[model samples]
Target: MSNKHTTLRKPVLLTSLPLGVMSFLLPIYSKKLGMNAVEITGLFSILSLILIITRPIIGKFTDSFGRKPILIVSCILFAASYFIFSIATTSVLIYAARIFQGIATATMTISTYSIISDTTKENNFSKAFGRIHSYKSTGSLYGCIIASIILSFMTFTQGWKMLFLIFSILSIYSVIEVIKNIPESKKIVTVKCDINKNKSRNTMKLLIIVFMTCISSSILGPVFMIYMQDKFTNNILLLAYAFFPALISESLLSKRIGAFSDKCGYRYSMIFGILICAIISIITPSANSILILAILWILSTLGGVLYNVSEKNIYTDMIGESCVGVMYSIYSIVCDFGLMIGPLVGGILYDNVSHQAPFYLSGFFMVIVAILILILIKKDSICRVD
Candidate 1:
């Protein structure tokens, strides 16, 4: 990679470090802070709702106003929200912090993706995206390891708050890197949104797939920590182990899969990924040993890495370069809707049915998503093949 690519990749990695840390620790800490399942679900739902509503507007603005300004403002807000979260001791404060965090989180991901799509060519897009995922995974791994150590020594509240403070400072550094090193793409692709545009239709399809996949995938988010905490007694270690597979998948597997997709086709890759995840889900909950659970988590992470890479490529291929921001925004909104619903539904289902219900439901949806992808590929055969 060139210097520019290196520069772009740095901020992405830095920003994701904190995101990765918080992704697991936040909810677990929420429980430590005395919030119940209902409150936890409500907080995430609010975040998802805000992201669903705000992503499109942010994307559209990125087209006109440029990515840098949006990124700067958003990163500041993102970092600041961590401080808010650190100080939040009550359910109401947690909810408010998450809301702000949700809004701020949107820009980092959307703008970074838009920047990559804008800067690179079609042939390089998958590789670039893979690199981004790799960095993201690396950050996640580092965060999990660090968090695990921190939690071992400190109370959950102390560890979580300190983590936020450290990550917030890192996020600020990322902003500085973005301003100084990452240059804006000179080629601006203006979107001509028309009812008849094939791109628009494709964007809609991509959004639908994102929503379905996210809903299925996010079902384990809220309760996974609690389940591990109850079963293993050392929640931090289980959580750390659970995410280790994801780190490997993101850092190593996703890039290879992405490169393979460029030659073999994204549709097949995506379908294969979904099938693997569905199978894992069907069997994972029955694991009688920690070893089995770890193996299953790795399998699931591999599947997710494959699906995420292929799905992102499909979106980029369908929407083209000019409308990347808009396409991703729409994609984010739909995915957020799924994310919002997943925890709420999962919590309810676990309460009514069984703790394993969420995994079973996730598996079922993954299978459905595979079938849906096949239908989509057949319907849009020419575009997909090309």
Candidate 2:
């Protein structure tokens, strides 16, 4: 491992702990607040919209001011956001909390990602990201287990509130790590000054990949719980059952796939990943039993994991460490923008069309996007850090 990864891994893992718990629980929490399918979907879209609005601004600030400063501030807000989630009773209040959460997340994402780019070896980007994601997945899986125990002990509403409080407290450790242990990214100043002289490829080309893939991937995200609720309910263990297998697979294989990309190239890995995702999404509606559905869901997740990690590698490879905050913020904008739009469309379809329709539409979209972008992205390395 690189010195920087060694330095940053502990704090990153600590920060990721809360996120894991929130991932499986947030939609359920939204439902408990009396949000229906549309309302719940709206919450996700709203979060993404807020992220879209904030990413570029956050990107610019981090790139200009430095990474650790932005990260510390975002962590403080992240802790506060959980407190809001604990107290939220109405949809409006939840929306307010999500906006704050979104901004904090936006900044943290760019800063953290930029830091990885700053510190990791050039050839190790994919492997480094994969390892980081595995750690995050491990954190998420544990969070699921923890969430299950909490839910078993209390009502969903009460358990959720307690979970948020615990999340808030745990976040303090992350804050401390950032302040005391994590180093500021050394590239921030140099990158900020050199962008004008650099002819690294245009942002628009890479953004096309982020935008389309995210939209395809997120189309079913908002409606998934509501769709699954028909087959399973009441037990938080259901969330565990639904997610654990996939999470385990992702954590285990994330590094292998990243290493594979390093050897075979990112383009092929991406095409294969999205192709598998497209196939899985199309067949999800056919799984009449919960067990079968879970299996297919697990497969769907792998495709997404592969695609995401590879794409992150490809983006970092194109941009190098310089201006990464801005580059990734641009990438985040595309992703969140797609995420925002997908739910609104999915919400409309879930209510008007069949619940399964959005999944099918999403799958088809990925197939087209994969084929199109395959043609657009060049085979040559667009920019070389070395």
What TM-score goes with each of the models?
0.88, 0.88
Mark the regions of model 2 whose C-alpha exceeds 4 Å error after superposition: 18-24, 27-41, 89-93, 188-203, 231-240, 380-386
- Per-residue lDDT tens digits for candidate 2, residues 260-279, read 66666677777888999999
Clashes of 2: 0
Question: For each candidate, C-alpha RMSD in Å?
Answer: 3.3, 3.5
**Candidate 2 lowest-lDDT run of ten:** 377-386
Q: Relative to the true structure, how large is the alpha-carbon lDDT of every model?
A: 0.74, 0.75
